[model samples]
Target: MTDPLVLGPLLRHVGETTASVWVQTGGTATVTVRSGERSWSARTFVVEGFHFALVLVDGLTAGESYEYIVEIDGAQVWPPAECEYPAPRITTLVKDRPTRLAFGSCRTSVPHDAEHHGSHGVDALRTYAMALADGEVEWPDAIAFLGDQVYADETSEEMREFIGTRRSLDEPPGEELKDFTEYAHLYALAWSEPANRWLLSTLPSSMIFDDHDIRDDWNTSWTWHEEINETQWWHERLVGGLTAYWVYQHIGNLDHDALAADEIWSLLAAGAGDSEVDLTAPLRDLVERNDRHPEVYRWSYTLELGDCRLVVLDSRAARVLEPEARHMLDPAELEWLAEQLTGDVDHLFVGTSLPFLLPPGLHDLEAINEVLAAGRFGGLPAKGAERVRQIIDLEHWAAFQSGFQEVFELVMEVARGTKGDPPATVTFLSGDVHNSYVAEVIDAEQHGAGSRIVQAVCSPIRNPMPKGLRVAMSGFSRSLVRPMRWVASRSRRIPDPAYPWRVTHGPWFDNNLAVVEVRGDGLHLSWYAGEVVDDDHDHPRLREVSTVDV
Candidate 1:
């Protein structure tokens, strides 16, 4: 029999009474998910010749551990026959149990061998897998991959070699992904490592895509959209990127209610049978429409775990590119986000790919750059400023002032107990800055006895920023921007932030992964880096870089 399982069997959306498992198959097959005495089976659906199934297993008791087996057409294909480690188990959330989550971003797909260690470093996720396998660390409730899950635009040497065997590298956008098939290969390369693969199978995961998932600086500006749309291959690239993301990442994110309400799933359910349903045309059209009009479909989601709420924002796709009214999240998305940012929970975790609270100096710089890029200086200077914006990646929350203020005010309101009973902490968990840091916002008026607002950033799970760039960033954030802030405030004519903030921890540049635990009224965060101790590259060790409590 053919190897039906291609990718996943990834555990997702584990709720009180329901759970979802996503898997890719080789052909039309019955995908079965078995947990204890309960089992659910569903036939795979086809999209652009790729077979996938999202089996929702019901009747699960909350706070219980259930060992699961995935089978395709009556043959056990997961938890490999020769496996020595513990079998994959789904542990549902318990009401009184504290919530622990692992988060990081910007992982590159490269061989784990010692030769590639210098370029890629040891994969922190892989090392975490080793710790989990050995029972050295407690498994998190879920792993939130903030963004940059796959670098579609930046292919590695191995990826290039694989592309060359299948397609000509001389074509436009050569070496980068051109279609769905290439993206499939990219995901395979990213998740196929033995240790990481096992970790994914058992652990619940949530993800969002950043620029690299499509192309670098995706939707950075109106001009960027125009330029990429003019490219001959962009149509296929956009469709493939989004469609694959839905199949591989987005579907599993929804709870039972949301999944049942989804239009695409409704269509797929209507056509479920022995034969695979061809959804290429409809799926492509959906992606195309969503690209042009982001409000047509929502990518952001919220999870209520115990006494905390995790709000994962889709900062990339839900953008308003209108020059005069530019915002990271469009009106509909903004409203949705506002609804989710309530004070009912003990801890409010806002997960955005780009950080909400950057270093004050850096934030000032970006805000100033935004005014200049808006033709404040006019003519060639404005043009140059625009180019600089793209070059230095200035398209963050601070660059979009209106959106930044709106969200900031809302967060402040929540923290001040204006929305409801205040959370103990309102923490912004983010990645993509290539460095890890913690910053706390101090309310000028000492508002209410509400939440302590903090920004915690952990990034580059495998990729590392260059030393020169790190030095420059540290220097600019430390001293240079202090003077620039005065000029920026004067030029932009915007008042100072109501609350002043300072970086309290880090600016560390190690390839790292971070974990956050929420207990009662306190939160603990720690960063870990993978180290090849004793020259055993295969069995890399995880070293704790720093830990902070708030």
Candidate 2:
């Protein structure tokens, strides 16, 4: 066996009574995983040039921590001699508990220093998260990675150098990840750190892909697709992007129930499935079709963790982009989401890559951009609108007005108790915009229980907004957006008790990590960001930016 590329060793709830441990490694080796005296072993095989395995040990209780090890290739490969690349031992998931969840997304793997990190600002968020995972602090039950788990479009200088080292950057698609091998290596680089990899193995993670995971403005519009197809390398680019995405990210996010119920899964179960499920060919076809017809096979899934129900929606890929009746969630997906939102759970957490709610001014800006694309404001040439969309990432929820409206209505209905008693809270967790903030829809007339609704926006676990753009976003939200919002509210309001005014819980402009804890009835949320104290890189301190009890 060659050097093992171990992944996960995660604990996930299989049923109300059973739990499973998931792992993916590099070579064919006997992997012995132990929770105490009892142990289970599985033989991991390298298929499609990637090592993978799943071991299910039943009869484990929820909310209990179990310590385990991985022995591969006749050696204890976990808990490495040096805490460097390729992570250490695995731990059990935070099974079945009303617990704390740490979630934020849009991380780029730049260095931690300010000037040395190649223009992406200091990776304070990564450093802080790594510190917490390395036992500098307590670990959260689960970490929800909202989106941009990787940026396929924007490659840092270090990444370019690494890719250029092995692969020819002068090829068809250049350094922007033209194939699956590049994507695999990118994931390795992203998760190779001992602390971060161990953190993922221990904490149960749920994720959804965003535009950057594929390419910038992946599905901004049909016109964008047409223009991309016009490029010589786009065929390979799309195939590689979607194929690697399915293998590296999407496959793990599914539960047994979801997998069994999926069309592709059913085919695999029948043994009539085209290539083996783990191989590259099947993934290539499904992902290719997914990119070609974004709405054909839905990538969305739901998780019922005790009393908490997490509905992670696929805002991208499955978009219904017809102008007459558009939506982010197609009718079928909307129905499925509405069914899940019966609010039988204590807290309803909706995870999507893009926030359903954006700053009203930004929302208006999107509408204007759309209108301009239709040639109202002398839009770009024929493919001008598509080009502009790619430049500014115009494929957000704001762009898909109908789908955004549907999800918003669904959330509002759930919050208002359409099925059972209203949930203690209905929180939308999102990360896409490089900045993070908590915005609450409030009834200005009264505060407290009569509040409209709460939406928490956390983003860029590592990436920080550019300085000038951050300043502009702040200025627009404060100066221009505030007054214009008031005037617009006179005509366009979200009905009585649903006053659309937004009160930000905190300020922005910091690379940060956020945690949300549900204790008793109220939900306590806190934001933490790292502050550099010295050039020696030892005195990094994590200070609380803001706290709110909603």
Candidate 3:
């Protein structure tokens, strides 16, 4: 029999009474999810010639573990007989249980062997998987992949070889993904690694896409969008990227209620119990419309676990690119965000792929650069500044003054107990800077509310920034704050940040994954990097880089 499951049995949206298991099959097959005496089943639906299913297993008891098996066409296909790891299980959330999450981003699909190790380092996720399999570490409630789950624009050597065998690399966009088939292949390469695949099967996961998931610096500006749109292959690239994202990443993120409300799912559900439905055209049209009018659909979501709430923002797709009124989140998204920012929980976590808070020095520089790029100096100087902004990746929260202030104020309000009973901590969890760090917002009044604001960043589950560039970044981060603030003072266009902050923990450049555990009113964060202690690539170890408590 053909291997029906290709990409997942990826456990997602696990709750007190329900669990969602996402899987891709080789053909139209009946997929069943068995947990103890209960079972949930669904038939795979076709999308661009691929069969996929999200089986929602209900009637699960809260705070209970249920070992599950995937059966395609009434034949068991998952948890292979030769598997060495523990049986894949789904644990529903308990009301009194503490919130624990593992988060990291910017993982590239490449071989885990030694030759690739020099460039990509050991895969931190894989190492973490080993730890989980060995029962060396507690399984987090969920793993939040902040961004860049797949590098659509940056192909690995293996991926390039596959692409070359199927299509000409000399075509426009060359090595980058051109269509849905390539993206599907890219995801297979990314998640098919044995250790990571096992981890994904058992652990609940949430994900959002970064620029590299589509192309580098995606939606950075109107000019960038216009230039790319004019390219011959960009239309297909956008449609495929977003469509695959919806099928693979976004679908599993939603709860049963939200999934039921989704129009795309409704369209697919309509074709169920019949011949395989080819949703390529409708899916492409949905993506195209969402691209042009981002406010038409929302990607941001929030999940409440115990006493805490995790708000995952769509930083990339929800951007407003008007030069004069640039904002990271469009008005509708910002309004939605405001609704999510309220505090009734013991802890509040905001997850953004790009950090809401940068190192103080870098923050000031980007804030100033934003004004310069907006033509505050006018003519060629502004043009040059815009180029610099794009080149150095200065576009972030600080670069959009309105967005920065709006979010800052909202966070401040939540912290101050204006929205509800204040959370013990308001933490922003992020990745994408290719480093790990923790920063705390300083409260001038030494107020209890002010003490709760913090930022935790973990990045590059495999990719590492070059040592030379790391050194340069460190020096620049240290030296730029004062001068950039001084420059901002002289420009009417730039405004000073309301709350001061400092990097309290790190700027570590190791390829790492981070975990945050929230207990009652306390928070603990730890960063782990994969290390090949000996020459054993198959059994790389997870070494703790640092841990901090807030």
State each model's CA lDDT, in order: 0.87, 0.66, 0.88
In the predicted model 1, the residue pairs found to clash are: none
Error of 3 at 506 (Å): 0.8
Q: In candidate 3, residue 500 scores what lDDT?
A: 77
Show the lowest summed lDDT stretch of 10 residues, model 1: 441-450
lDDT of 1 by residue, 164-278 (tens): 9888999977989998999998999998889998999998999988888888888888877898899999999999999999888898989988887887888877886677788
Clashing pairs in 2: 63-95, 327-403, 328-403
Off by over 4 Å in 1: none
Ranked candidates, highest lDDT first: 3, 1, 2
Clashing pairs in 3: none
Candidate 3 local lDDT, 369-460, one digit each (tens): 77777777777877787788888888878888889989988998888888998888889999988988898887633554632899999988
Model 3 weakest lDDT span, ten residues long: 442-451
